[model samples]
Structure formats: C-alpha cells, structure tokens
Target: MDSSAGHTPEPGSPDEPVVVLGVVAAPGQAIGLARKLVEADLTDHIQTTFPGARWQLELLEAGVVQPPAGDAEIVDATRDLLLEHEWDLVLCLTDLPLHVGKRPVVAHANAVHGVAVLSVPALGATGVRQRARGIITGLVGQLLGADADDLREHQKSPARSALRHRVRQLGTDVDEAGTAFTARVLTGNLRLLTGMVRANRPWRLALGLSRALTGAIAAGVFALVTADIWLLADTFGGIRLTGVALGSIIAITATLIIGADLWERGSSRQTREQVALFNIVTVITVVLGVAAFYAALFVLSAIGALCLVVPQVFGATLDHPAGFTDYLEVAWLTCSLATVGGALGAGLETDEAVRDAAYTQHPAEPI
Candidate 1:
C-alpha cells in the first residue's frame, strides 16, 4: 500500500467486498468523480485542469453520478439515502462541502457497531468517499474496545475537544453580554448564562444579577404606579419631592456594578439601552402600579373594603417640596427592603424568579 500520495489498488477478489464511505466537496465534485470512474473509466485521475464548464457537463450527462430529485434539500437527501441504502460499505459522493462524519450513519456505526474510519486526500469520487467510510468505521471500532469511553468522554479529546470547548465559550460570551445589558436596567435574572462560566462566577454574577434586576424592576414598578397619584401631577402627595424609587434603583445598580468592578476590575458593565429600557419600564410601571392599586380598590370596593385610594389622575397639591420629598421617600423605600423600608414592600417576591427558572437548563448542554 502506497500511503504517500494514496493507497494502492486493491487486489481483485470477486467474493470479498470493500465497504466505502465517500465525502465529495460538492454536488459537482461527486458528479464529476462518478462520471470519470463510470462512463469514462478515467480511473487514474489525480488533479485536473480548471477545464471549461463543458467538460463538467460532459461527465454529468454521461450518467456516471446521480443528482438528487426535485424540491429536496441536498444535505438532508444525502443523509437519508446514505442511511437507507443497505450495504457492507457506504459510499458518499458529496458535491457539497459537507460531512460524512456528521451523518447518523457514522455515529451509528462507530458509537453502536464499533466501526472505525480511514481518510485520504480525495483523488476521485469512489476513492474519497470510500476512504471517509473506512475511516469512520475504523474510529468507531477502535473506540468500541473494552476501555472505550462514551461519546461524551471521547469527545473531550484535545484536538476535536478544543473546538467544542471554544464553541461553548462563545455561547457563554453572548450570554455574558446579555446579562450585563440586562443588569443595568429592567428586571430579569441573568443567571441563565452564568452556568457555563468558570466556577465561582455562577455565584457572584448570577446571584448578584438576579438581585439587581429584581430591585430595578421593583423600583420601576413602584415609580410607575405611584407617580400618578403621588401627590400632585409632578409633585408627591401634592408636595415637592425627590425621586426616591428612582434613586434607590440607581443606587442599587451603581453599588452592584461598582462592587463587582472593585472585586473583578473592569469586568462590570453599564449599558445605556438597558438603563433606558429600565427607565421607560419604570415610567410605565408607575402608572400601571398606581392603576393596579386603584383597580384593587375598584374590585374590593365592590365587596366594600378600605383599599380604595382616590382614582383620580390629578389633584390639588399638598405643597411642592414636601410632596416631592414624600414621593422620593416612597421611591427609596420601594428599592430597599432590608435597607430602608421593611422587607414586605421592596424588590420582587421570591416566587417570581424561582418559578421562571424552573426546568430551565444550561443552553450549551447536548440533548
């Protein structure tokens, strides 16, 4: 066997057969190779000139290779045919630069039947596809030995494994970007992405992010609800006031980001979109929150209860500074449960995130 440029021709044995799996570069590649070997019997082809398209078609018209039927996606058809065709060996002639190794055939043969594979730079359709089939079978058989590792363990091998690991890292990078953006505003846990980060990070970023998001959300909601009935249109309880909830949300975000930055310098994020969205949601949440309380009153008032606050959108001022101060105090209290106000009024209830995160798994894991 000349393993230099290629394998030597097999000695003729009518009874014994060679099992081959082919991987051609594309549809044209497969067609050309099959034509060369079949119609033209041009068995000795190594590399050919960039001959005109006429030369390309002469082979296809010769019926040496097969083209897929109408309306079928090429890659899928290849797999279906490969799996359906029963033979000692599988020959793949791909015109597309796709993978035979990626096929279920290869996976089944190696992972199940313990086959292995052989690879060589393709010369013709038959040889290239044959070698791919052989190599896959060979690998499967080798891995199927007594000390065999499961597909998962074997996949951790250095050469191929790094690619897998890098893909996972890329996924994590996207996730990290998302978390950082979300943490600065609105309310949603970023823990979804933290699982794939290196250990200990899951604790710091995931847990911390969840808290910040919840605080921001709570503050936004409180602001939206209370701002309407706050006091007088722009005033609080009809008196001038500071924006307490807004301040609390900002304080929490700043403190969290700053703390993280102090510990893991330059690692924290500040995104304007996130902050802007948070602000918008805060404005809306305040309106909704106030309305919601009124709604609660309207519903309870039906049953006769004291939960009713005035349902009016505007009213006489209590006094600008005092009203504003009161609103600010409410905002501040909205952001802090364990800090300023008692635990009942601030942040989100515990059940919200726990309920959402239920059954959620790390995105990178394989089925």
Candidate 2:
C-alpha cells in the first residue's frame, strides 16, 4: 500500500460530516499495517455505529506521536493537531498506555471538541485491525451522542466501571464532557480491563525469545561440551546462582531489544518517549519468558552431561569436588553460553517478526 494514502484523503462532498481519523502507529511495517487496517474498516465502522448521516471519514496517518501525560492534555494536543484541517472529528489511536489517576484508561475524548484518543493496549488481545476499528467507531458514536441508547445498552454504566469504590471517568470527566450522554466516556470498567490484560499476551514474550533462540541453543551445547562444569558450580553457589540465571535472561532480552527494529521516522519528543517506553516493556516481557526457557534448557543440559560425562575422568584436574556440584556447575556454564548465542540469533531475526513483536505507533524520522 502507498504510504501516501495515510496522509492524503479522497475528495468528498462539502455537505457531509468529514471525520479525519488520525492513526498514530509505530514507524515502518506497523505503520503500513495500521494504515491498511484503518482504511479497510473505518467506513464500515462509522456507518454501523451511526447508520443515517452522510459521512466522509478519512483515515490519516497523523505521523508519529507519544500520547501526552494527562487526559486534558491529550485532548488538547489531538485537537491542536487537526486545527489546521476542517474536521468534524479527530481520533488519535496510539500504542502508548493512557491513565486517569491510578486506573488505566481505554480511551479519552472531549465530546464538545469532537476529539478522542485511545490507547492500543486497552484493546487487549483483540486484533489490531478489529479493535482499532471498534474503538474509533465507538468514540465517534460517543462524541456525537449518536446511537446513545443502543450503545449504552451494550455498555456498562460508570458506577459498574471502576473496580474500586470510586468510579473515575476513563475518557473525559463528566462535568467537563458537556453532553447528556454523560455516563463517563467509554467507562473504564472490568470488561475493559479484562480485554487489556488479555491483549498483553505471552506470545509477545516468545517473540522476543525467538529472536535469539537458535544462538542460545547452540551456545548451550557448546558450553556443555567444553566448559568446566564443576568449577562454575563452585564459583556460583546458592543465592549467587540465581543471579547468574537472571543475568543470562537479561543479557539475551537486552540484545533482542537493542537490535530489534523500533526506530520511528519522527524526531519529536513524543516519538522518542513512545519508542523508549515500548522498548522497556518489550525487554521486560522477553526477559521473563527467556529466563524460564533458559533455566529449563540448563537443567536438561546438566542432566545430559552428568549421564554422559564421567566426573572421575576430570576429577583429578578439577579445582573443586564433583558430586552434585558438577550439575550446578554445568548448568551455569551452559546458561552463560546461551546468552552469547542469543546475540547471534538477534542478527538473524526477520524484520517482520521484530515489528510484530513491538507495539507500533508510527514511522521513523528521516535521517
């Protein structure tokens, strides 16, 4: 698909309500995917949500941007970005997580201004294309006060939204919204939270680990064959052993994150902030998954070594006693070796998989 499609709109009638939906996705393949996803679904979503009015909803790639801190700031920023353009509605969809007070907000909108911004994370395990379409359409119905009765029946009231006693508005505060549709803009309820949690899948962690899988495995095998397992066990004993295990995981995860293709074409601070946050989250999730895999591999490698290699053959040359010490020693050596392997795997990882692994918002800044 042409990258230009995201920025340009098709000619339309002046009488129709022109809603320019600005999707700010991560740079590169993800942005392209975002554009395609929005273009294919925006028209149907608007029509389904609002039925009657003649509409000209255009999906624009609003470049790359990190969502601002506060809900009010986000609304103002979204409105300001589209002020130059005559728009009936401006919806900015970002990968950055948004929050109101301590609770996570799915989406935020200023109905009076006809502007809304939603977090991609809030969509939770829903496909990017489907969830993006739903949220944007829902926000449109929300901002215009169209299909209120139909939407409300399907949606929960603000009272039932908060997991805690205080039901804080997820989008814009009720008093500030200035609409009778007042029941809290996209009520941040239990259902929303459930979807968000479901969206944070473990497969993402696997993707990170996959980046270095081959190298990690090769290195483990090589280390088992050559490294002095007995000495390694003696050096990294008890609590210190845990540190070695954790270090291996961190090293591999960091390699994938640093080497992964996450650069956006935007030079803005918001772009940089979004990219930084994305990297942090990706690295952490990868670490959790990779660590578990590495530990299991280490144990299996140790068992294989103990069953195959006679400790007595190297006992005389060993600095430490063999016994059960050999098993811990071999495991530590193999784990450390796997990290080196991870580095090699990082280089071989595909561009598609890397982009799929990270949360996308927009394109990279031109060098």
- Pick the TM-score winner: 2
lDDT of 1: 0.28
Off by over 4 Å in 1: 1-246, 258-263, 266-306, 310-364
How much does each candidate deviate from the true structure in C-alpha RMSD?
22.3, 15.3
Task: Flag regions of model 2 displaced more than 4 Å.
Answer: 1-58, 61-154, 158-200, 203-211, 227-229, 238-243, 263-280, 319-321, 357-367
* lDDT for each residue of candidate 2 in 109-223, tens digit (9 for 90 to 100): 4443446676666667647666666666666654443233435643454223221111111111122222322222223232432232223343444444475777777877777
Question: What are the TM-scores, per candidate, against the unseen true structure?
Answer: 0.20, 0.48
Worst 10-residue lDDT window, candidate 2? 164-173
RMSD score of candidate 1 (Å): 22.3
lDDT of 2: 0.50
lDDT of each: 0.28, 0.50
**Distance from true position, residue 110, model 1, in Å?**
31
